[model samples]
Target: MTAPLHPGRFAGKVLVVTGAAQGIGRAVALQAAQEGGAVLLVDRADFLAEVVAEAGASAAGFQADLETYDGAEAAMRFAGERFGGVDILINNVGGAIRMRPFSAFEPEQIDAEIRRSLLPTLYGCHAVLPHLFARGGGTIVNVSSNATRGINRVPYSAAKGGINAITQSLAMELAERNIRVVATAPGGTEAPPRRVPRNAAGETEAEKCWMADVVRQVKQSSFMKRYGTIAEQVAPILFLASDDASYITGSVLPVAGGDLG
Candidate 1:
């Protein structure tokens, strides 16, 4: 039930959003479609098909593991074949896969954090560039987290930091081509209950404590001292993706209730 307030903001545009099956990704895709954009919703989950159906004729779905280059390639190919070109790319495929103190993390866990929260944005951007270049210009809105500043999830923080760096560097490099690259660093957000959870079952009490600490830090760090609603997070994302942000590039806007991270 996320209706479009800025109708026609994305009219006639073709948008590609990764991680489109749920949460912020799903919200963005639906809002974009409602605003008159043709959306290509991509996710590895089969449930992505349901989101596509919900979008009706304005959107289509593709299944792909966006952490890999092959998955990124396949998604871009599908978009090109179906939509002819991409006008906006929303790299919303990352999340903190685990939350723990930096010292408590295994090396493999560190690697997984980077893979889960960073590589998709890197790979998705790389795969979609050629398509955007072909179209002569486009916009990219990367979803980063305000936890980059306050967290028990150290590895995830680093991954989102990487997102900030890439957003800055890519925006400069692509400016001449009119390809604006920007990011939104969201703090805590409230959404529908997850059909899938990030934490595994049978977590130890110690692990539970660690997760609780993360939640505490997120709220404390926000000036509002509360999590934001899904619509609050979606508004700035859509703004950056829309032509309204044509003059804005290489910037990471924080949508964290005054948490300036």
Candidate 2:
């Protein structure tokens, strides 16, 4: 869907991507870089640096635990120091911290889920707003899930619902500044086995088993036989981050392969 039309759409721009160690984050960073944008990859003290190095001069990485104040600050500093400034911020750092029947989560578990899956995106946006405003304006792409449409994924649904709201509110708030804000709701995605390691933090065995099961569940939920690949999902993101999407904002462009349709 996001073909190379102009080829130089993002030339000279600087984009910061969180959760850049792997999966959707990694793919988005590479896609942006290939389109000519400088990339600042960020993650918790690990995956970031490796991806950045692979990006060469077109990219660099920031290692931090974004759930904390100091961690977010350090990442902001890293982006500024590496790229001179940030013109685009992709809030791609979030996941199903804990999945269960929406009615089953303990209050504490819900809180943790919100902090881990939703707050980091907010913090990243806050960290980059100054740079974006100073430069007149920029674009932001927040990756969410089809669960945001109130599907049955419980905690993930709630977290993504919040992301959807934030994307809308921020889009309007930044519209006058010429900063575009949008979110993607992906479902039935193939996601492809990532080139970047899973989570890159060496998730505990229990976590690994749970995540692996999720992949199975997602496939089973779909009517179609296969899941959408990362590249297909990445298409809308590329458009949202490029000049071609300048006239679009506050749109929850779904990449869910007809799952929510």
Candidate 3:
């Protein structure tokens, strides 16, 4: 079950949620709009229009490839133009594209993993800073992962570790500007099947085993011994992005049922 919504909590705020076509990003965009935020749902996926419709009249959609700086800048600029200015940003555009043992990964595959899981958040944060500054200050909530210490995804792990560092360092630098940077490291989450798979190629037997091991490690590491719901992940993210967490910054809250990765 989802948490109760606090109507008007985000009244008068403009929020940009990357990867808003699905999963936790979709949940965030919908709930934020319900709570009175003017939301810009950003994603490159064609399904983004569906989410925008589901979010009602308060939300708009912007399609962009967040992996590039140009795309990130364009999204933020469009948010500013559409909503007056950005008061919050949820950097949610990332995921591991492949699952395999570190030694088994090709060099190009490793590069792709980093590019997929890291660059969006990096570019999003950089591009949104000026807009947040223009709004006088705002909050940034990055969606990191607790899989940083898990098996068969070293490149993705490194990418999320960089997210932690970005949250910390950027918070320190932006505190004086009244801008807060924070992150949530989510563990295994249960949601509907993806409309777009991370890896379009089929998995081989060996790759399947590697992924199974990752699932095992994730369950064993978490006290809950099960995956969380998409609503579970969305609650904390919106909390951090809201003024309720105004005093919080530079912290990476582990939504991993006690696995502090």
Better of 1 and 3 by TM-score: 3
Cα TM-score of candidate 2 = 0.84
Candidate 2 lDDT tens digits, 73-150: 678777778878878888887776554455655787777777777888877777778888888899989988876544
Q: How far off is residue 62 in model 2, in Å?
A: 0.6
Candidate 3: tens digits of C-alpha lDDT, residues 1-261: 985698999999999999999888999999999999999999999989999999999999999998889999999999999989999999998888888988999999999888888999999999999999988999999999998898899999999999999999999999999999999999999888999888888688988888889888899999999888888899999999999999999999999988987
Candidate 2: where are CA atoms >4 Å away?
A: 1-6, 149-152, 192-225
Q: Order of candidates by TM-score, top first?
A: 3, 1, 2
Error in Å for residue 195 of model 2: 9.3
Q: Is candidate 2 or candidate 3 better by lDDT?
A: 3
lDDT of candidate 1 vs native?
Answer: 0.90
| Residue-wise C-alpha lDDT for candidate 1, range 1-261, written one tens digit per residue | 343479898998999999999999999999998899999999988688889999879899999999899999999989999999999999998887777778889898899889989999999899999999999999999999888887668889999999999999999999999899999999898889766665545467888898899788888888899999888988999999999999999999999989987
Task: Score candidate 2 by lDDT.
Answer: 0.76
Of 1 and 2, the candidate ahead on lDDT is 1
Clashes counted in candidate 2 amount to 4
The best candidate by TM-score is 3
Clashes of each: 0, 4, 0
> In angstroms, how far off is 125's CA in candidate 2?
1.7
RMSD of each: 1.4, 3.5, 0.8
Q: In model 3, where do residues sit more than 4 Å from their true spots?
A: none
